[model samples]
Target: MTETAVEQFTEHQRKRGKRVSVVSPLDAPFFETERGSLILGDCLQTLKSLPANSVDLFVTSPPYDGQPKYGNGEKYERDWYRDFFMAVSAEILRTLKPHGSFVLNYRSKRRGAERGVLQYEMIFWLREQGFLFCEDFIWGKPSPPPGKFNRFLKDAVEYCFQFSKTNDWQFFPENCLSPARWDAKDRERRKKLAHNYVRANAPSGQGRKRVQAGPDMVRPSTLLHLEPEFSPNPVKHPARFPVELPSFFIKLLTQPGQLVVDPFGGTGTTGLAAERLDRRWLLVEIDPTYASIVPTRFENGR
Candidate 1:
């Protein structure tokens, strides 16, 4: 039998003193670290190989419909796009744990005068498929591309839709809190106000003389104001999202040692975030060219 490309790649990495393995029966992992595996294959096929109720979180920004740049010079028709993602979503629903979350980062493109409604349609479809609609986070890009449109404003925000298989899904909002901006004077004023409110509302002799101010860290809002990678050409992947995007979700929805999977891994950004956050990850990318560069990104501390 011929050695697969991934097998050869694994051998090469092993020669470099890196601890790597190709343990999957379907295919050897293109690259493996202590905490993650980058697989080179179709995501749907790879996802099918996994057991049901195994994934802890599914986070990915799949290729947009009708985007030729990501696809190989051929535009994906709306019907084809819907069919493809629906198939993938079915697998995601099957594999995702009952207490897990799936965060989909997607944006629709405008055509001549009309904006696409596929993104919204997918949300409805997902809900119908029994996945609970948890919340939606707006990824506000601080530096969006400049464009002059006749009918619309500049596109600066993308949607990160969160879904869960059951109502009892795991979420740890405290882990992703934003720093509070209250000074000592502000804290003192709030504390005094809180004390007065308590005193007025309490029973005749039950009121306390003082009350502490709120926590130093507050819950983050739904709107995430994060800048994309500064460099025009940060990586070989054409549509790579900022690492902070996945990092935020990982911190919010998972603990230290859970499993996170990105079926449409582009340049393995999700895998990098998972590794940094001490979670196990699996990244599946169909494009070999894109999958090949993932190891380099990991090696260079990207």
Candidate 2:
């Protein structure tokens, strides 16, 4: 008997001290690697096949309702879009581990002279479905497209809404700390303020007390500054987020070898980030064209 590619990959991972547990629920994956699998299917249906409490983290940027540039020629209405994702969210709730996290990268589309409230509506709907609303992180695009508008400034940010199955979700703030922004002079000032506070609170008879400067690295804020990155391939997906976007959440919410899933796996950006971080991933992409690029991405070491 010969070992299949997936079996070989699984065994290889196990020998390297990684727990290989993510498996394709479908008959076979469109593409498979040592650290991930890409399944070509409608995510709504495929996600339902995954066993309950299987996925550790879900990171994805779903297609906006009327955006047909994603190779889908049809434009979906707002109500249909909401219903579609609500069904998807129900499955996510079922598939996610009790302590797992779901990070949705989304932005509402603008209609005529006013901005749509779809993003907020989705948030409210998700909470109603029993997903605990965690925190909303903003992805600030430093290099927004150059344009002038009559009634609005350039759209410079998108929302990354974090949700969890339970309050006891796994989160490692230390893993996602950023370097302290203050310089030497600022540090000295902060130290002086801390010392003054300690001295003022202590009695006159007490010995003089010292306060240490703050940590060199501080916890990251909800706002993240990440410039969008283009795909190295000439034929690129219409919408692809920077790898840093998913990498941050993967580091904060998951451990090595845990399973991470991206339902709307456009060009496999989430899988790429997960693989590099030593986490297993399962990606479901409906478009075959976008799905074809994923294996090449991994093969070319992008």
Best by TM-score: 2
- lDDT tens string, model 1, 111-179? 779988888998999998889999999999989878898779988989999999999999899999889
Q: Once model 2 is optimally superposed onto the true structure by TM-score, how far is the C-alpha of residue 265 displaced, in angstroms? A: 0.4
Alpha-carbon deviation at 190 in model 2, angstroms: 2.4
Model 1 TM-score relative to the real fold: 0.85
TM-scores for the candidates: 0.85, 0.86
CA lDDT, every model vs. true structure = 0.84, 0.84
Candidate 2, superposed: residue stretches over 4 Å from native: 1-26, 191-196, 199-203, 206-210
Candidate 1: where is the Cα deviation over 4 Å?
1-25, 183-213, 232-235
Deviation in Å, model 2, residue 267 alpha carbon: 0.2
Candidate 2, 50: how far from true, in Å? 0.8
Give all candidate RMSDs, comma-separated: 4.2, 6.6
Per-residue alpha-carbon lDDT of candidate 2 for residues 48-154, written as tens digits (9 for 90 to 100): 88899999999999887678776567666677667888899999999999989999998888898988888898898999999999999999999986788888999
